[model samples]
Target: MIVSLIAAVSADGKIAQSAEQSSLDWTSREDTRFFISKTKEIGTVVMGRKTFGTIGKPLKDRRTIVMSSRTGIEGVEWTSEPPADLVARLEREGVTRMALCGGAAIYDAFLSVGLVDELFLTVEPVLFGDGVPLFRNGARINLKLLETTKLGDSSVLLHYLLLK
Candidate 1:
């Protein structure tokens, strides 16, 4: 199974303004395009409860799974322990490639479990004075370079693979 962590962060690693969950509009246009393109390659996406709330519904043309303690949501599969178990369940459901989309907490969850096989990072050009971090607390995992690319005017794609 290929578990991917996909996100756009500022050059300094902040994902959004600390006080605002809705003010991530400055990440940049090219980066957004680049991110969509990156996500197109995956068949399923896993996100945190908050991230799913922000998106409002399941994404089109892909199998979407939201992780949380609540189990009965129509579109969500409950993900409680060893977050990797979520990935495994998804794989059982015919999802071979899954991307971890985030509001920070989910990204950290996937990272902590060493389930991330690739990281599709888009480095936006602007920096926020204060913002939510891309990750707060998570387990340590090592990585190996897979590939890198220059997307456009101000965005770069840093792709990596799990070391193991």
Candidate 2:
């Protein structure tokens, strides 16, 4: 499976104001728009439990996979497996591609295991003095910038390929 991570971060590289806060609440409209459109194209989105809680339910017309130690979500799939096993399971299920929409830790898990094939990030204009970071416990991986484009008046979108 091709795993891609997508996130919108503050100028200081934070995804939220705090662990309790949601990036969707403060991220730019441009980033939201881009995220929605991209996720629609991808069709499958995998995120951590907290990330799923922020959204509160499965996204319409897409398969939502939540990574958690617990089991049994009614509408979406739940997994407690390691990132590599999860990716293998997804591949077995015939998923060609998936979006790793985040709450930081999930991003680190996938990236640390070297499963992320691509990363799309939107850099918003505002800064958070302290917040949840974009990635935690991640490895230092080489990235090849695929594209950089201005999203709005102050935001920018960066697309990168994780060098294998």
Largest lDDT belongs to which candidate?
Answer: 2
Name the lDDT value of residue 33 in candidate 1: 68
Q: Which regions of candidate 2 deviate over 4 angstroms?
A: none
Q: How well does each candidate superpose onto the true structure, as a TM-score?
A: 0.83, 0.94
Per-residue accuracy of model 1 over 1-164 as CA lDDT, tens digit each: 88888888778888776533642466666776665665677867777777776667676666677778776457555566567666666668787788788868888777766677888778778777677787677445677878888877777878888786
Per-residue alpha-carbon lDDT of candidate 2 for residues 55-86, written as tens digits (9 for 90 to 100):
88898888899999996569999999999998
Candidate 1's TM-score: 0.83
lDDT of each structure?
0.73, 0.89
